[model samples]
Target: MKRSDLSHTIRETLKRLPPPYDSHYGVVPPAPPEEGVSVAGAAKALDAAQAAFGKVDAIAAQMKDPYIVSRVLTRREAVSSSSIEGTQSTLDELLSVEETGDDGARDVSGKLRPSGGVVPWHQRIDFAARPTVGDTLKS
Candidate 1:
């Protein structure tokens, strides 16, 4: 069967099936019907379902036409040199990484060692107190 037909069948089957059930404190509650199952609800459900089904149908229809599919899938030549650059800039902003200058750049040494350089005595003591995995060798 066609993919769209199969999808519609599956959707219909899901609609006919009983809703899920829930349990609380040894009590089981009957499953609520799928959203918009009533006449009023069905209208809303039908609209949404039709919209989604329409999209799938359109895609399936396109797939049946090899020329249309080829046109849809064919890579087009770059329209503008800055298209990729613009896309990257938008991505950088979305990622919260500053794309301007070296503002966000990090220095490895600064990360490994902080300013004023000396390790605190308490930290050193803690390090000495830590038992290395190799300490089991002695046991």
Candidate 2:
């Protein structure tokens, strides 16, 4: 093995600036999707979406009380969402906690949903009208 003499040059690295840096927060609107593009995949996806939405609309129409429907659906969704976030709270326990305050029965009673009472009616309505897949992707 032969040892070769090599002079290595050290490059000076730029140091990051100290705290109190300038930051600007701004919202930039996305450009609208162009019309009249005959993409095969997009058309298929749109059709599937319309079909799914039609089924949902039909189910919604059959329900006598939209409020109760929304409440039940929202509670189920909330339970799933909470469980994903590592908080395990069931629908019955959630309702009980909302009615009589947290009695320490469930570990996550206080954390799930609004402080008192079920999720607000307005919030549920907003959830129902939330943007669909085609709406966001197409527009």
Candidate 3:
């Protein structure tokens, strides 16, 4: 069958599945393919499928009883917030190090020093010493 037909069929099948009694009950339908069944069309179909799955998940979530939902929501919120805070802290550390140039450099003792160099290590290759594979292998 056509890609659209297959996508629609999958969506219908998912919707037919029973939703959990305690959670949001909604299904985000997949978007129809804009073009024919090419790579791009396949990508679109995947996106649609993901959206539809998200909807179903939300619906199922809503179907849950209120107390359980509240507890779960609270836990999720806490975890999310904690995760965000952790990410923010990490980002802040990265940015601060970038700003101050303290991203773990090497000291005279071979210890990792704070980052504070003009250029990144990867970009600072020794162009002068660079030899082609043929040159290095030549007798």
User: Ranking under TM-score, best-scoring first?
Assistant: 2, 1, 3
- Please give the TM-score that candidate 2 achieves against the real structure: 0.34
**What TM-score does prediction 3 earn?**
0.20
lDDT agreement with native, every candidate = 0.39, 0.56, 0.47
Candidate 2, superposed: residue stretches over 4 Å from native: 1-43, 84-86, 90-139
C-alpha positional error of residue 64 in candidate 1 after TM-score superposition, expressed in Å:
6.6
Q: Given candidate 3, what's the lDDT at residue 86? A: 40
RMSD of 2: 13.8
lDDT for 32 in candidate 3 is 79
Model 2: ten consecutive residues of lowest lDDT: 1-10
Candidate 2: tens digits of C-alpha lDDT, residues 80-110:
6665565566788756655785544445533
lDDT of 3 by residue, 1-139 (tens): 3335455556464433355643432345677788745688788999999998788678767885433334333333433453444422222333344468655734446676443232232123323335578886993
Model 2: colliding residue pairs: none
